[model samples]
Target chain A: MTASTAGPFDTERTRSVRGASWTAFRAMLLRDFTILDKRLPQFVAGTVMQPLMLVFVLTNLFPRIGQAVGGGGGASRFSSLLMAGIVAQTIIFIGIFSVGTEMVRELGVTGEVEDRILAPTPIFVVAAEKIVSGGLQALFGAMVVFPIGAFVPSTPVYLEVRPIVLLTLTPLACVTAAALGLTMGARFSPGTASYLFGVVALPLSFLGAIFYTWPSLDAVPLLQYALLVNPLVYASEGFRAALVAGEPHLSLFVVYPAMIVSAVVFTVLGMRGLRERVLS
Target chain B: MFLVPRLQQTPGWLSRPDISILRPRMHSLPPANISRPGGTVTLASEGESAGNGATPHPGAADVISTTALKKVYPGGMVAVDELSLSVRRGEIFGLLGPNGAGKSTTVGMLTTRVIPTSGSAVVNGIDVVAEPARAKQVIGVVSQANTLDQGLNVWENLYFHGRYFGMSAQASRAATNDLLERFRLADKKTAEVEALSGGMARRLMVARALLHQPAVIFLDEPTVGLDPQSRIALWEVLGELQDEGQTVLVTTHRMEEADEHCDRLAIMDHGRIKAVDTPAGLKARLGGGASVTVRADGEIEKLASQLRRAVFTTEVQVVDGHVRISLPQAEGAMQLVLAAAQAGRFRLTDLAVSCDNLETVFVKLTGKDLRE
Candidate 1:
């Protein structure tokens, strides 16, 4: 039959043809997981292994050298601080490596970005989905770190587990980490991103306030200020502030607000960067 | 030779509400204001150029428009100038140009892939830039790069695309089954895309583009890396799409493809459209009905200049060993061409003349080879 005769079309067909926003969002998430599902093991080892090893080495080896250093009390204190810092490090590593690397691969050699770009959903949403997925990976990393940090060397940094603090901040920290990942992924070309882990990421980790308290770096005053630039400082401080509240070492007041602010700022900047990059 | 599409029978339009016309702010322009240079139409306007209501669909020979389309790179490269062009709905519109001439860029803009620099276009009254989501619903895009998913089987790919377009899984599978049988992909339904040869992959890509039943399908160098057999297969698929009452916009540097397959095309250069027309229209506008080439032993230019003054010759030039000339008609002019060659004291080594195809018209307008 001729096409002219083929239709007794309804006027509502246009409206009926719409894709569900949530369905579209879910489809994107499902597709990404399907594609990367095989790589989950790699993510787990990458996230969990480093934190466990760092906790072991710092908690065990450092206490012995404390006497000669004359800052032995500070060393033990530094070790506890370092445990929180290690958790933050795991989050950063997972965020940067997992989401950032996948994005580079998607936008670059594979041309998979086309699938995401052409979808009915906005590009920022797709980037956010990846960021969210990476956040899940960071959460998994934190779960592993909590048990190890609490149990190692038997002097638990105890008694102040504010369920509210733990619940609220863990998700926030993961999101912040993911947002930072998305920002890096969206902004850098894959060629530039090739060096992300070795160069950009490592330096950010060292200066991220992970290993030491922000106020304690007065010995190297410039270093103290410089560390403030890193997002990890906020994350670790937040985690420590929540997990070990009222501890003699750190204050919760500074950590909570700072982390929240950083997460909000990075999320906005990252999402904007993603939109601009994709639309371009 | 035109391969008449099996599906070429015109489809009846169902009386639907003028959904677009209800908007009080749509851009309106007179029919004549649409520019068709060298026979191809471009909607190159800034502010509301997209008209409201059920105007003639671009394939119907009436209107092709774009609205407020802009594509600005993060690194800040303006690939497409804020440009618009419109074609009378049914006329074959050709977009012609050299590599990086923004032919692909314009195609990208029109297909809703790369956003326009700052303006939008409407293909058959579908707002391409402003309502790209709506626009894409009616457009099929075959990018310059191959977009066929390599992991899926051929039928699976078609089925998935159909589902992606909002068809129910059952309906999509049914349609996919039919298409697979029709495209001869039924036998290859279980075979992975990577296993297919180059020709098969190209065919599959065309199949995937059509699965959604888009109104206007864009082909960006569909035959770029294909062997002759593969290219011919792609042409057949395109011919079929056109036959099915679908408007097709194809971008290619292959003059022959544009000349033969395209109903009309625009010649593009340096991010601006140089000319737009049917292959025949472009040739006629280039000062010759069509071009013919002849090879003579010595003094080719002298023979060329002599042919230039002849009554039958419109324009003539000698390049390499060949004397190229445009004649008023390809049939009768050959005798005149030979006579002129003989009278000029130039011996014809080899001579051939045919209707002026896209090659001559493109070179004449762009001052560059079409293949380049």
Candidate 2:
């Protein structure tokens, strides 16, 4: 047998691993978007349908009854409040429930979460990227709901459009929704997550200023403060301040900074939970 | 738990001299047939020095090596125990075992999904326990469960995996297209993976694993639930991968698959390896021999004892209704075996000797059938 010499194969092989780090991270992000994109229709349905139904059902029901039955001309203003609150509510609900449920199912049925955990980037990046994509979806859902809300009757209190407030609060609200979803999604097992969606999400929606304003509930101090703790409260209130400046609105000072701070807190919690879940 | 630290604490083979420090513990067996030939196959040279120690062919560096690798679930079940193995560059190695065996656990540890209770592995020369990200980057894993995004199309699945490996969008697209073309899946690229047959999904998983062109690939029962034709098609694909100089470690319970596809294999049971060798090397070491099966009336174990003592036979054992014995060759040996069985008061119904197979090797070593 003609046995040849050594090193050629080994040296040439080692030289082949010339790949870079950035290329890997980009690949992971692209993959996440591809998966999210496929669920686009369901996202649009939840975002547009839920808010539109709430606005139309509430707005039309008001005028059929006289001022005495519908709480006077302010019925129109209340519908406007309902419109803004519902838009915020849909974004928060869709982002948290949709993203969280998907995560739970992914962790359950297929162990698809293993794909991200095993990717080249740190596990934290994978968690953040998934939430970021969820936030983007939330933004699109909110945008779609606003135009549809215009068709509702009762001369709804029109939006005034404060650029500074809208620009700051909208993204913050989206991030907060996503991060909240991430924290719960990573922590809960899939079996009990539907219960969370029904009990937790619905309750959070009610307490977080989706159907009413904060000062209107001033008689119940505990409820007002308790609702204040819900991130959706700050989001809806902040949107109200931006979209209807002349109307009864929560002060921009409290709503704007609170929205930003809550987003940061949720992001931190999501990052930590995600890191633990992936690494463990 | 003890095995995990031992694997991780020990340096890699390149730095450590004691390659066999995590040597597999032997289970008690009936005393070896003292009348028959017995020799220890030198799996590795004993006194070889560290680092520059001559490895018969210090040729291609090992793509993956585990040192005292172990995994123990919280419920006190030890799935994998002190597994030490080395897969060289460009070789297709198989972990062959039965149901509930730790083949999947061992694969999980190597792939960095399930954290080991102890030990460590270096995959593609990166310390898996110490630097999992680096190790992950170099290895591609096809798990027993389907991880494809069912919502996305086949091309998207391939593209995403490529992107996750950090390839550019254009690069991923190119790789996805090439893989689709190679797997003959180009026509079905736009279809959802959920709509594909089991075989198609499996082939796509393989294509996905190959997108980044990982240096080491872990295939855990890649063709487990496929139909016969699909199983063979996967076999050809795996062979092609081996031919392309990629190192692959596959775990499977299918004896024929392992026999046909593996360059080397380890037969595992009860969380340990019973035997490891090239398919032919294992059989030849059993001796270039054939196994005789004689189904007879009366107590088969008694016949087995009698056949063992007979001068005509080399080794004998009772397996179900038959007295199985191995001989160097079949021609004259079978007649002698049958004559001995007749003298032993055994009424033989069916007697035949067939060439040795992987199934026979597993049974001979583990005292149980692979399907068990």
| Winning candidate number (lDDT) | 2
Query: In candidate 2, residue B314 scores what lDDT?
Result: 55
lDDT of 2 by residue, A18-64 (tens): 24235454565566566657667766776677777777667765555
Query: What TM-score does prediction 2 earn?
Result: 0.79
Candidate 1's TM-score reads 0.73
Classified by CAPRI criteria, candidate 2 counts as acceptable
Per-residue error at B200 for model 2, in Å?
A: 1.0
Model 1 accuracy (lDDT, Cα): 0.62
Question: DockQ score of candidate 2?
Answer: 0.33
Candidate 1, residue B270: Cα displacement in angstroms equals 3.6
The lDDT values for all models are: 0.62, 0.70
Give fnat, all candidates.
0.05, 0.37
Top candidate when judged by TM-score against the true structure: 2
User: Which runs in model 2 stand beyond 4 Å of their true positions?
Assistant: A1-25, A28-41, A67-73, A247-261, A272-280, B1-59, B283-290, B293-311, B314-351, B363-372
